[model samples]
Target: EGDGAHGGFPADGVHRTSRLTAPPPVPPRSRLPRPRRGPLAIVVAVLLVLGVGTGVWYINSGQFTKVPPLLSKTEAQARDRLDEAGLDVGKVKHAYSDTVERGKVISTDPGVGDRIRKNDSVSLTVSDGPDTVKLPDVSGYRLDKARELLEDEGLEPGMVTKAFSGEVAKGFVISSKPGSGTTVRAGSAVALVVSKGSPVDVPDVTGDDPEDAKAELAEAGLKVRIADERVNSEYDSGQVARQTPDPGGRAAEGDTVTLTLSKGPRMIEVPDVVGDSVDDAKRKLEDAGFNVDEDRGLLGLFGDTVEKQSVDGGDTAPEGSTIKITIR
Candidate 1:
């Protein structure tokens, strides 16, 4: 009984002992309520990301652009193109250009496809076409002097045509095409009409002696000039072979007539082609320095064979003389 009383405890004591020995119940964790994510929060997050992206983009490429292609474009077109590219037109200048059209954009300051800042000015060099100059009066001037004047006026001396003029002296300019005071492009060819004073008939001096030719030309109010180099012609040696301005041609008074003396006709041996075809014979004769004349009679109209030749083979004939061949 005593042991029971000592060893065994009362129910209240047992309960107290159990409560002290065992760990106290952990108080239900008092967590704060999780905040609910709403549409407004999502929107704020998205806006922050967009703002960062925009800042990066603006810093890199937003303030500049490439120059637009403006070569060969008109002023209005270039302006429009620059406007579209967010650029301004700067100093506009005009210059002459042979290849570019007038009023067209020849080049840009920044050059096409070059990087430039937005809203910045782009200088343009517009074409004014070719340069122009006023033609000066060169009438009555000597041909050489007139050419000099034209060159000084930025013009090219073009074809010179001569005509008889009673007022203007020989070898002087009568007038110019496009006339005086006419505005013409620089480097333009200008034709001039030169005067050949009072016409005089040129006497035929060919085949005449040099002394006779000179005397005859002098009597006709013309001067005579003998060429240094003599040419081979049908006329005899030491005789006048050719005269230019030629026979019956008109010339100016006191004008010089040049005479070329002859060194006699050159003789060459003919080729043998009696049995050859007509075409072959002609080729051989022509190659031997002689002109070919085909004599195809009624019977030889369809003949191709050369049966006879006027100058036989191995015979000497004057160079450039005609060689007749009979075909059968």
Candidate 2:
């Protein structure tokens, strides 16, 4: 009885020890996951918030001012008044007005009571007085002088044309491009044509004998004419001597000139010594042409026959030139 086990136990005489224990069961784990953010997404969100703040600041800072609508105030007075009102004066625009005097303010930008930030500019239109000015007649004045007068009157000169002026002297201003009394811009240009003196055609002196070269030149357009002639004794006499400046030369119209003429070359007549010995004949002719010669053989001893001679019967040569004769 003492060894028997309780229901279904082994009846052997061995008793069982306590069973081995296992680790306590693990506690059930929570399934929660960690939150994550990318670098680009975080940067974009930061930039968006900064951009919104900057835009709000830009809108709040922008501001504009309006000028008073006052009329007929002097420019200085308008500016002073605006400054006194804690506003700044801006660009002054000028315009012609029959109703307002020059340098007076005609109107202002944005009327009075315009809310503006500090340093806001208020623009004003200024009067340039009346648009009309009595034009000075500068037709006869020199171009430069006329320009000065026009500029003084705040007018411009325009257009120049040149015309022959029988009354006006050379190099003087003839007239302006535009007739006087024309209204134009203050800096407009005036054209001027100056006198260049009288115009005349050049003279012609071609083919005229130098002896009459001067007279012919006078008949033409030339007032002054010069003729140079050198006689070639070897050339035919009385023909036009050699001319210098050959034919055509230029001279002012109506200019006078000096003339040269040919005096026939100084000449000596050839001596006649026919029927004489060749040597003696040669001596006479040579003296005229400047020498003497003799033939060979029996004719040489007798002084032979005079055969050929230069200048045959009646030809002329320069006074000092020599003529030769052939003796047989």
Candidates in order have lDDT scores of: 0.93, 0.62
lDDT of 1: 0.93
Best by lDDT: 1
Every model's TM-score: 0.55, 0.31
Over 245-275, each residue of candidate 1 has an lDDT whose tens digit, in order, gives 9999998999999999999889999999899
Error of 2 at 73 (Å): 19
Q: For all candidates, what are the clash counts?
A: 0, 11
Model 1 residue runs over 4 Å out of place are 1-60, 71-77, 97-104, 127-130, 205-209, 227-245, 258-328
